[model samples]
Target: MKIGILTSGGDCPGLNAVIRGAVLKGIKAYGHTFVGFRDGWRGVVDGEVLELPREKVRGISKQGGTILGTSRTNPFDGPNGGAHNIKMTLVSLGIDALIAIGGEGTLAAAQRLSQEGLKIVGVPKTVDNDLAATDYTFGFDTAVQIATEAIDRLRTTGESHHRCMVAEVMGRHAGWIALHAGMAAGAHAILIPEQPVSAAQIATWVQEAQRRGRAPLVVVAEGFIEQGQEAAHSGRGLDTFGRPRLGGIGEKLAPEIEARTGIETRATVLGHIQRGGVPSAFDRVLATRLGMAAVDSVAHNRWGTMVTLKGTSIESIDFDTALGSLKTVPQERWDEASLLFG
Candidate 1:
């Protein structure tokens, strides 16, 4: 069987590991040939591809980002979009099955394509850890570790300067990264998309820190809109590829908190930093497991399903179930983190 693979949405650590694992396993175990589509769905639309062999995937397990590249192109968005033309491209390329690795949008696209008669298997990939089915996605742990380290370093600078350091992490609809990172770094306050905080509330947190003569550290998610300011006419709904962006909440909130609190505030947008560099030991192992499972699923002909981590084992789930709803940070988790806040 000729299998096709593509990485969609934003890049993250452990992506290359997934690719390497799949290619290595598929080639060794089943003798299945593999082709990699570049720039996500656009590559499929344009039929731009590269052949993947064991040599091509060597030493990519610890590498960050996708060796195949990625993009946020949504084929289902417009009239002449790439989604409509994918079938013809697949036929021309003689590709039998697809392994789509990405976050929500990528999984949703895979689900729709499967419904449209394309054989696909999904691997959940996100730094947010917001997918409902899986116990945790591969990249989320790496991102949190990176964010936590950044916060720890910034804490020293913040205290030395007596400044309110606001470090932004990535989370679109959930605050998993911010919640875990902030708590890990002992942040004075944590803001997340799940909890839209007001300027006044944040001001109080900063002011109290000032009163205690201690610099405040705040960790915020990029998608955390400040109350009514979220729905305004802004470009917060598009990705870097200019397809429905999902950032800028911390950029907007940082200035507001500074103005309201009268503290020397600064915003550090982690942006792509959270997604780059080497994968953690945990992520590499998890991604390798998922990749192996994905190859096994392809062998089993488990189309339209995704490989997910359930408890101690990797399990298979329907693509629709994985993409059905975003897994958000629960109130109890938020409250637990809140206990440390001033």
Candidate 2:
């Protein structure tokens, strides 16, 4: 069988590892040929492909980002979109099955395409770790590690200047990255979309930290909302998924904190810095495991299903189960982390 593989959505660490694991396993165990789709669903729509062999995948596990490239292109759109058109394209390209590695949007498209008679297996990949089906996604650990390191460095600078530093991490709807990284970095305050906080309240936390002679550190998620207001909007327009661009909340709060508390304040947007560079050991191993599990699912002809991590084990669950809802940071987690807050 010739399997077509594509990495869709935002690029992340461990993407190359996933590709390497799948290709190596497919070639050695089943003699299955592989083709990589470039720029995600756009590649599928345009039938753009690159050949994949064992040699092509050598030593990619330690590498960051997808060698095959990626994009946020939606497969159900455009002239050659929808299930029928995609199936016709696949037939023309001789792709027997598809392994779609991506987050929510990509897997949702894969689920629809499978419903429309395409053979597809999904491997969950989200730096946010928001998917409900998996205990954790492949890129989440790497992102957290990056964010944590950035916050740690920020802490040192904040102390040096006696400044209140607000560090923003990526999180559209959930706060897993911000929560874990903030706690790890000993942030004085943590803000997330799930918890709306007022600028005044944050100032109080800053003042309290200042009282203790500590430079205050604040970690905010991109989608976080100030109290009694909507979430911060980037005004940069929406993506292909029709979701608003979320960011700049930390920047917005920096002035407010400085004004209310009269403290020297700075806002550092971690931005795409969290997405680039080598994945942590945890992420590489998890991504490789999911990649191998995805191919094994394909070998068994398990279509419309995705491989997910369930605690210490990697398991397969129906795509709907995974997409039913997002896995958010629970209240208990926030409360536990808050105990250390100023």
In terms of TM-score, the best-performing candidate is 2
**Which residue pairs collide in model 2, if any?**
none
Residues 204-283, model 2: lDDT tens digits: 99999999999999999998988999656476788777888888888889999999999999999999999999999999
The lDDT per prediction is 0.86, 0.92
Give the distance in Å from residue 4's predicted Cα in candidate 1 to where it truly belongs: 0.9
User: What's model 2's overall lDDT?
Assistant: 0.92
Q: In lDDT terms, how accurate is model 1?
A: 0.86
Error of 2 at 213 (Å): 0.4
- Local lDDT at 298 for model 2: 96
How does model 2 score by TM-score? Answer: 0.98
Please give, for residues 105-152, the per-residue lDDT of candidate 1 as tens digits: 898889888888888999999988989999999998999999999999
Residue 7 lDDT, candidate 2, scale 0-100: 95
